[model samples]
Target chain A: MSASDHLIPVVVSNVVEVNPIIKRFEFKHVNGDELPAFSGGAHIVVEMLDDGTKRKNPYSLMSSPFERDQYAISVRRDDTGRGGSKFMHEQVRPGMQMKISAPVNLFALDLRARKHLMIAGGIGITPFIAQMAQADKLGVPFELHYAARSVSQAAYMDSLADRFGDHVSCYCDDQGESVDLETLLSNQPLGTHVYVCGPKGMIERVVQTATSLGWPAAHVHFEHFLAPPVGEPFEVHLAKAGIDITVGAEQSLLEAVEASGTPINCMCRGGACGQCETVVVACDGEIMHNDHWLDEEQRAAKQRIMPCVSRFRGKRLELDL
Target chain B: MTIQFKDESFRGDFTYANSPSNIPRFPFPFPEDEYMYSTNIEPHHAARAGSPFENAFDVDEHYVAEMKDRALVLADDPGRCQALPHMETAGWDFLELVMVSKARDYPDLFKLTMDGDRWHWINKPLQIDDTFTFGDSSTLPCHPMEYIGRQVQGDHAILDQRDGNLWMDAGIITAQADWSLDFDIGMNFFEWHAPVPLAHELGVFQRALKFLLTLPQGQPSRRLNWTLTVNPRLDTSPENYPKWGPDRMTVTPENIGEKVHLRVELQTFWRLPRSNAILFPIRTYLMAMNEVVTQPKWGRRLHRVMRDLRPELVDYKGLSRYHPILVEWLSQFDDGAPTSPGIFPD
Candidate 1:
């Protein structure tokens, strides 16, 4: 089947600016049927068609899983990044028809955990919104430590506090409030799982502190979808598909391949999901590894590449796409 | 369409026999004249009407007898149904998946009603009607997995995903083909499949595991696997090998058509919504050589596939005992004619 065959048609039912930077968009099935059920920490790839160009961006579903009639996602407009989020903010309006992929969870909760500790930064609070709702329904104890720029910039602060009571903790950078990762990671109960989603620095600090505090690697979880960085233009030869595509300076390798009419199954266009991993048949220059999927050893081996974000800076590069 | 439930037996008297109409729809596993280990997974979309692939869960004429046999096996050994303590939520997820799918796909045979958390389920085929809270296990008569598993055909295994691997955490497997769920519980995907010959060296499991790890919520996939069985026995498990092993030796040239059977498993994989675990259902279909030859296409292709089958696979699938006699008997059905490309009656 073609890649677009599985997309679910949806209509923008409502849009609300939660904060100056974040806008919450509610999507309902175009035919008013119940959307597919999803679990906590799941994300859907919203497909945006603009000027004959297709852009897909993964956004965490902030609505509760039980609410199947509509799905809600909070988008933090990235002015400097690719045009997907900008389209969501400016062009997208109520009654507009669009398509989105089914929910895929790369950061699902560990149900066996006795306690859950969540850390969020800015838009990172999106996934935790649904997760907190699930934890409450399951009667599992959890605590949220969320940090934003300030009270005015914090999205869903009041409603979260009002609904979750003392379980919600807000930290504002302007007020000199920051999460103490070391203190948060120390002396937690056994079987406590820590999930952190935020900026690169914040996620690294949480992971490092948890490790230094003797937490097992399995108990530490993090989700960060890296936007493909702009790189110099390069040429890639699709050996199996018998096609050649040029990775423009502004476009990702995945976009270039998709434009060539090659069926590449991708879920989370971001670097986190390994769905778009391709074998590096040959390369004359260095392979820029920017994805979170491959290990240090695999990256050094240079036999595989995550086309979503990774790039090639060489005279000749071939992929077994 | 209403189904005509068959009153038959899978053990003891061994009175199981497929009706004449059911033979054409028998999921003949060989799409070609030869078979080897390949991923071979395809989208589990609903296909041709009246075929087994037409529903999320296929309920055939043997549904009543199969459920009865499962109950007998479970009564003899409760160890067949097992679930890890941490898999309770997954069990609930599995119960919801089956109840919802069956009620929607086969409305004539099943019904489900939901009022918030309160759920009422009815199974016309099994004469079961019960109401329970959606997520509360105490509301059900047994564990959610076991409670719903008993009402469905085939054996169901709930796989838990973590640390980049799938774990066989919970399952109700009474109709298995030699594998034991009790021993396989808590084993990772590779660990449970370690005993399978040749698939690992060929990188089949690696590719399959990677695909399943990202299996989306709505799109499920399925593949077919087959083995040879002597009788229409659903409980050819290793634990009960002695009771059924001797049946293989009873096959002779005269009784090969009646005594030997071809067992095909339509294994499907689905992603659970709540727990993010995968539900694997192995639906077994049995057809005696006599019923198989009724479909000329199946008879011709089965003979060619069996005659050219790899020696390793013949031993692996336990076809060594009666392989020569069975293949020789099937040779008469093959009249040196080229069969059609796909697996369907000519």
Candidate 2:
């Protein structure tokens, strides 16, 4: 991953619509020089404009980690998701330069596993592309299970089949072909590790099934695919800054606070990482906790808030900052 | 009239009805003539050897009174009832579970109907009758958990099982004895009981978790946890420290009988059918030490337990300040007192 502290401007060198909802983009240095190298499963935060508001969206690098000439990312257009993906789909174009943070790997491949089991739902397949490449380099036995609504929705299926052949399996819900996750989890070997990235319901089901079947939690992994649900606009008071920031209906608390000149540290921006949790001084209303990082008790405490995805609907909220 | 206390906290209009039959079957908790935290997983329907109640969730004469007390607590602080965002479904599951069970158990008080994704609930006791879309939070008059919790005479929590562990995620905990729901939400079963002295060494928590994960759908299990409280107030959460903490330090022999309460929690655990979350209902019963000694055996047991309890255990139970006084007061009955509190009658 890049060690630079500042974000670098990268040009959108190429774009391809792999499916109805997914667009794969290739980014390269503006001067056409080799970009910073990143390991498998690393993601770079792309800074985009959502109707003039600054938005940072993290996208996993799908390109092989062995090279650094360009970086690849896939964005799924989710009309129902937060506005970041919508902006990436409609506004971003080739030849346009966008600011991107250094790559960071929050879902890196485990090097010690005897075998790897990769599961994906829809666009969740992006992270596994780079991970499988690393597993190949390590000569690790692996299986890639891809599930999609249909053949058309399964992005990169042909490429994966061409590369891994029988090691890749695709299940399309439209065609009535389904993967029995219980059976898949039950048949795994002793030292095998399973990685799942998908919609919330799918991830919960896979994790629960694996756990019920006695699969060790250490061997299971998952990443959330979409942002949390949005709530009404609210006002935030930064104690240290002594300013009351009005977070818009579509804006996250983290974005509003950052736009006001006090940037909070953040990683995934999807509420999966715990980097942006800020101490809440006082709250007069209920907090809609949207982070996967905090457990139920922490969410209920009202003492802390994950500014990235969490929001509130109240007159005023005070943050310790 | 509201009798105001020295701590600025006042007791609501309470009539001290001391009929032994009205005691509502306290689940004596201590087994083998000693006290220790163990897995102690018993079948939900299993009859307690000496209990006056028969069902997993037993409602007694105090149901209406306790519900009234809960309503007062909630009115003063609505933060006492919170159902996290993801727990919306579990809340509905809880609502339906109570309505259906109550409709079946006490047919006159509750009724539930289902038509596809819509449900109609009739709570005769609360005078609520409405038809709303299932799984929609807005359709309900209040948060689903609070709506049900307010009607019942117990504190309830929903624990979701994920990744081979149960998470104490959602609940309306208006009457926590000494624990804080704010600090325990989303915590695993073990983290919730970390303060217990020897549960870890005895593998009690592990055994309990295993038993809970394997608990069948309709079959609930129950266990007991007991402690001493300064008053009959149910909201003993740390958030109310300033209001109740000093009373613990000021208690003495003169008022120990009236100030000290033997608090026993009859905790019932069962799995929700729809959400698959475990529904835990904790019913608390508090009796003044003076009223308890009316039962000679119980008085002697309380005296012996308080005297022999380890110092660390007593401190952890929050009885370090006035326990010695409590022990002294119970010693008067050590040589066998009368079968009644003759001088303490209402």
Candidate 3:
């Protein structure tokens, strides 16, 4: 089957400006069919075709899993980064049709945990909105520790508090309030799973603190989708597809390959999901490993590359696409 | 398309037999002359019309009888149906999947109507009409998995993904191919598959596990696995080995055609939406040698595949007792003619 056969056509039904930087878009099926059901912490890759450019961005679904008629996602516009989120904010409108990959959950709740602890930083609060809905529906005890730059900057703060009551706690940097990682990680009950999603620094602090507290590695979870960094232009030869393409300095390898009419199976266009991992058949230069899915050993092997974000800086690079 | 539900026995009487029309659609698994362990998985997209792969779930003439057999097996050993406490949401997910798929695929046989949380499901063949809340297990008579698992044909195991491995956390495995779900309930993917020979060394499980771990919702996959059984038995499980193990000795040259049956499992994997668990359905189809040879192409292919099969697989599949006799018996059907390429009748 063609890669597009699996894509669900959706209409942008509603758009809400949650904050100055965050805009929440609601998508409903183009055919008015019930969208596929998804678990909390699930994300969909929105395929955008804007100004003759194709870009796919993965956004965590902030809507309740029980809601099948429409899916909601909050996108944080990054003016300095790639333009996927900016397109969502400025170009996308109600009644506009878009294609999206099926909902995929890379950051799912560990149901076996006695309690669910979520820590969100600024725009990272998107995934937890749906996750908390699921936790509440499942009758699982959970607490949300949210840190934002300020009250006005925090997306979903009022709605979360109004719905979750004491289960929600907010920390605003403007007020000098911050989540004390050591204090929060110290006395959690056994079998508690901590999930963090946000700025890379906040995630690292949470993970390092949890590890220092002797928490089991499996009990600590985090998700950070790294936008494909702009790099120098390079040539790539797809060994199997028998195609040669130049990845522009401003384009990701995944985008360039797709532009060449060769479909690469991918979910999170950001460097998180391992779906777009391609075997590095031959490379003459250093492989720039940017994805979180690969370990140091795999990176050192130089035998694989995540095309979505990772790059190559050498002369002759061949991929088993 | 309507199915005439069969009323037959899979145990004592061994009354299960394929009709002339059903033999061609038997999913003859041996696409080539020889068979060896391989990942062999393919996307479970809808295929040719009138084939088993045409729908999300295939319900044939054996639908009613298989459900009855499942109920009997559950009654004999309630442990056949199990779900971990953490898998409750997954159980509900499985229930919703089966109900929605069956109702949509075979509206005449099954019907599902939902009014928000209240769902009304009607299984015309099984004579089941029930209304219950969607997510609340208290509304059903049993755990959601078992409740729907009994109504469907096959053994289902829900594999919970964690620690970069798939865990067999819950299942209703009354109709299995020798493995015991009770013994394998809490084992991880590698741990449960440890009994299989050769495939592990080939890195088959590792690759298969990686593929399955990232399996997206809405895209299911399937593969065919085959073994030889003594009779039309459904529960060829290790727990009941004492009851059916001796039947292997009964497969002599005289009764080879009547007694020895080719058991094919249409194993399909689906990613459940809510729990992020993989629903593995092992749907078994049994065809006696008498029914199999009814198709000339299948008869020739099975003989070649059986004769050249690896000794390790023969031993692991428990075909040693009748291996020689069955191979010799099947040799008569092979005219040394070249069979066609895919697993389909000429």
Candidate 4:
């Protein structure tokens, strides 16, 4: 029905519940052969079937990049989300086959860097797990600074501690501890590259701190898992289709349109890719521009919207498809 | 005046005058009675026999002082010089272009000899003489662009033409007037200049891009853009806004003469013959309002232009609070002024 549906199939061979809402799923090629190899910071879209509707969500591969027999992905169920993680949590089981896209990496380790600083928050640690392994093989020094809600919610803490010892530092909220990103970043030698994958506030703070300290933009990298909260849903009139569609409170504009039998070609679905950019023919409401694909001026123009993440509110919104 | 630091010394060749004959030979930027943003680009023209201006790449009296400032700035903050991963070739191209420009303009002071891949470059000002193979990053002290940028007075930026759009790909821009080269890198021409008001609606930037893309490979073009600054300092970037923003609001009538400057940007655009990248060099010249008033025609025309500037444009240029005081200060000389030189082509 969509570009995501045309994917290679893999079977979930094993699952492990690391935390209250987190599960580690091990996937292997359906043909029982070696899977395609990926470097650090690669993510694959796992298409989940929710009430007969497919919801493709991106998850970072936690397993070592050197391992090609299977891919390990960690999913943290968000009960308040749009039902993709919830469906994977409640419906998916071992031996179940699902379609997945090839690994796409928007964030990759700088091999030429003198050192690598990997920082993560909550489930954002998934990507760093593979990055650290790559750094180890390349003999490049690396340190992981992780922040989690609580000790129980710090997935793979024991494994990370056992493997990395003092190199892995976890700041659990329950322990009343926090990370001093400034001190960590400031002390690093020149040519040290930093990669941050975490909550929106955490990522923004790290980037701002790095920039203020005069770090080149090329040295700082980041990735986000979830889009910001969409405000009150509204009705969207497809000008070319000559039909009015109501986008629900829990659905994206793209999803709502697809439910109406019109699916737009989208790749990242996470708002990084501009494949789903749609023109705004007319609008009587304020559009919540949440996508990173648009610059400040483009967002101010209000002529186009990325329905994959951005949403609208108020009385009426018309989109030119 | 000569300044020496760490075994590197430079002699400034600046000269000023009270009579028109002894004028500093600087190009005045105003062309009309009023100022507005437009795609005012024109083909590169040769300087006439009596013209007071220099060509696209000219080393003037401020060269030594500006180079010293560049050294200090780069020493304090190296982020000002950056070349993204994909801009390695463009960096080499930019470095070669600047070296060639200097050697051509100041043959007695600088020399560049190229034989196959080996290049022997000598810079008399900085006392730098070295021979290095082309396309080797390690052979240079730093990034290629940074190596040459430290010796020049003007800031450099290289834009690659790809997919029919010009992208601000690489550069070593330490003396940024008010923009951030780091934030603007990798952005297309329109996206980078999108925040400027009236330019988009007037199609100023769009028209400039179309003209820039069609510029012949070897024939360079030039344009001039002028604005007012609170001081002569060049690092007026948004990152350091707090340091300079308050000065604009607190300037008074008496102090306005010394505190304000007429900033002129001589922007040159040319395509690199080797890499096919467009090299943009911006040399900023600042003259104190006190010194500008000495020129009878310049002072009156500048006052009129400042007084008539639109309110929205004044705010856009961050000159809202200081412009009124500047206009009032210049009004004292507007009376019984000589018939204006009349609008001249830049």
lDDT of 4 by residue, B1-346 (tens): 1212222222122222123332345557776667787776665666753333344466655566678868877787777787777566567767877787778866877899988569999988778999998778889988888888888777888887654467888887866778988789889898898888877888787668756654543356777887778766776777667877776875898788867878778888976643446789887777778877777777778888888888888888778777777888998878745545533322
Candidate 4 docking class: incorrect
Span of ten consecutive residues with least summed lDDT in model 2 chain A:
A1-10
Q: After superposition, how far is residue A134 of candidate 2 from its true place, in Å?
A: 34
lDDT, candidate 2, equals 0.75
Tens-place lDDT digits, model 3, residues B118-190: 9999999888999999989899999999999988888999999887788999999988989999999999999
Give the higher-TM-score candidate: 1 or 3.
Answer: 3
Scored against the true structure, residue A296 in model 2 reaches a CA lDDT of 88
What does candidate 3's lDDT look like per residue over A1-321, in tens digits?
223348999999999998889899999999999998888888888888978888877789999998999999988888876778889999999999999888888899998999999999988898899999999988999999999999999988998999999999999999999999899999799889999999999999999999988999999999995578878899999998998999988689999998998878776777776778889999899999989889999999999999989888978999998
Which residue pairs overlap in candidate 3's backbone?
A285-A314
**Share of native C-alpha contacts between chains A and B (below 8 angstroms) recovered by candidate 4:** 0.00
**Candidate 2 Cα errors over 4 Å, as ranges:** A1-321, B1-18, B46-53, B114-118, B335-346
As for model 1, its CA RMSD to the true structure in angstroms is: 2.1
Against the true structure, candidate 4 reaches a TM-score of 0.50
Q: Total clashes, candidate 1?
A: 0
Runs with alpha carbons beyond 4 Å of true place in candidate 4:
A1-321, B1-23, B49-53, B336-346
Task: Return the top candidate by DockQ.
Answer: 3
Q: What share of the true interface contacts does candidate 3 keep?
A: 0.69
- 1 against 4, candidate with superior DockQ: 1
lDDT of 1 at B127: 96
List runs of model 1 lying over 4 Å from the truth: A1-4, A240-242
